[model samples]
Target: MARRARGTSAGLDRHRIATAAVALVDRDGLERFGVRRLADELGVDPMSIYHHVKGKAALLDAASEAVLHEVEIGAAEASDDWAEIARRTAHGYRAVACRHPRVFPLVVVRARTSPVTVAAVERLVTAMRAAGLPDRVVADTPGVLFGFLNGHLLARTGEGPEVPAPVGEFDAAAHPTTAALAPLLSDVGSVAEFDRLLDTVLAGIRVSAASG
Candidate 1:
């Protein structure tokens, strides 16, 4: 527990402010988040929050940082095989996104220049370069991999059901292939589905590596 500071500053610090801000956004969401609202949430003056985090943009970034710290992502060991490390990093990143679907958007859209974000990217890129990936492939991999992960996760973890309702059988006369694959089409967002798609992405990277 943070001991309430004696007087002038409302006892607020960056960490406490960050924790409260993230909680506020997690509950009511970004549309309702603001310094005054956060101050009300924290039982402090708006100035107190400003004293710590400066502005709404900075506070949002802080909240994103706090959420990222919850998972062990991009910890690609130097000596580990690059593909294995990539798999591990992908899974960890997925875990965090699954854990915080609302905040996950910030991770995707924000220009996160924090130490945690930097370090994670550094480790993963180092492992990739060590694996002898061509310069272009090495530079392209993170954006490509993360773009896939982000799009897939946003679809799966966003509002509504995890799996879509079955389309049932289509008219075979009009849509033979659609009728045949309707069952598989409805079975979406499973762990197996996520893994298989991730493998597909990795396979493409492998091809890129081979041709590079």
Candidate 2:
């Protein structure tokens, strides 16, 4: 491919810049991502990036938005089942996180208030509402669902130590349950565990909607 001019990102616009930024972050991670690096990848000077994206923070936000754009939330005509909609939406979010494990933390921690994020939230809320969920329950359900997914993804990414403390060494005499479960703790946080948890969550939402 012919190199883009050094001082001019000729054909690049905001979307193209954001797209490249996402690829760069996926490759290099947020810790090492910078305008200079992005410029280098694009075959342009660092200042040329500012012509498309505002700066580092805005660029990161754009990249995060790009990551979220990959999620396939589907349209209303596709499915009327609220549980299925929620399940698919949750998986879409999880898929992005899983693909970019290093970049996933950045997605989780940052305030995703972009238009794309807002549209996604609306889709989830709309699904719950279409399922005849109570107005208030519908309003809060998206946060409840995505919050669980984000928390779980963060844990899966090893945000903390595999074993935080030495619970295994604790006396089984005083805390038999804790000591006994310690052995199993290491095996937790699997896809099966996530499925079980999501099932429990959807069940609770159904009950709440039914009761309301």
Candidate 3:
């Protein structure tokens, strides 16, 4: 080994730090994650992490980026069918959330824009444009599509990967409609529920395309 520098942190890189940070957050969740905690997890001093990632906020961004990488877009994203691309992208996003329920929130709520995010959006619009959707529809596709995914996945992931406890019985006399729909509402995070609603969202997009 060569002579050491005056005072540099050793045996740590940005990727290693990011991977470890993601694991810590996955195990303990964002509320409890901290630079010191991550450093302890990595078996290093806190300053060593700072050397790689700058600080905690940056660390969170790094961790979020690392988790986002697990999303597998596959060949469907490259297909000519815009709706197919959208469905595949949605599945990938949900897969990431399911894999790391605690870390998924950071991927959305963070103010920073990630390249992975931007690329996914690009794929959506490119496929939409290729499908002959009008300009107005293509421009709005990402927000409208992601709104549904984010709202549903956040609730689903928080509920974890179990058969969610049913919404139980609701009185029909006082609030008939609410009572009747209660079971469906409580079925928040099921795979079947996600696919069913995602198809509805696709129908709406198709209407927009047809009208345009």
Candidate 4:
């Protein structure tokens, strides 16, 4: 075993500190993560982490990058089907979000300068360009696509629009129509839903790009 640093718990370095920080957030969540907690996990002093990372924010940036690296886009396919490319990109992003629901928000809120994130964005932009979308649409598509993805992911995590309340619980006397349509209003989010949504968005983009 690596011996502890003198007057400290164990050997420390940027890689080790960052790895521990990512693990802390993965296990406990971002809100519970902190340098002191990370130090405790590493059996070191709280200040020891500052030497490796600037502060919690910098540490979070590292953690976000770490989590994003798990998303694998693989080699680009040798085709110009932008719809397929967009689908792959969307699925890759959703996989990462589903894997780390808590850490997902970090990638969303923090500045995304990670190599993987950059590559992912580049891949999407390339696809949009290949599709012959207008320059403005090419630039704006990412925001719209990601917004839909984030919304869907949030719903998966129970933080987005909620399913309709049970029909039995509704005031049937005052709202007969709502009670009658309760079964139809019950909503479920699933992989099928995500696939359909991606397909629809891509189709709409194609139509919009063609019309302009």
Q: Rate the local accuracy (lDDT) of all candidates.
A: 0.76, 0.75, 0.80, 0.73
RMSD of 1: 4.1
Taking the candidates one at a time, how many backbone clashes does each contain? 0, 0, 0, 1
Compose the digit string of candidate 4's lDDT tens values, residues 63-147.
7777777777644465467677778778888887877777778777774566776777787788778767898778877777877
Q: Give all TM-scores, in the order shown.
A: 0.80, 0.79, 0.86, 0.79
lDDT of 3 by residue, 1-212 (tens): 24346575468899999898888878898888998787777767777677678788888888888988887887865588888999999998898888888888888787335787788889889888877899998898888888888877777777344644334344678878877777667656767778899999999999988987
Ranking by lDDT: 3, 1, 2, 4
**Candidate 2 structure quality by residue, lDDT tens digits, 84-121:** 87787777777778787766777777746756568777
Local accuracy of candidate 1 as per-residue lDDT tens digits, 148-186: 987888777665554543343347779877776776765
Residue 134 accuracy (lDDT) in model 2: 94
Whichever of 1 and 4 has more lDDT, that candidate is 1
Measure candidate 4: CA RMSD.
4.0
Backbone steric clashes in candidate 4, count? 1
Residue pairs whose backbone atoms clash in candidate 4? 4-10
Q: Which candidate comes out best when scored by TM-score? A: 3
Error of 3 at 65 (Å): 1.0
As a whole number from 0 to 100, the lDDT of residue 60 in candidate 4 is: 88
Candidate 4: regions farther than 4 A off: 1-9, 158-187
lDDT of 1 at 8: 45
Clashing pairs in 3: none
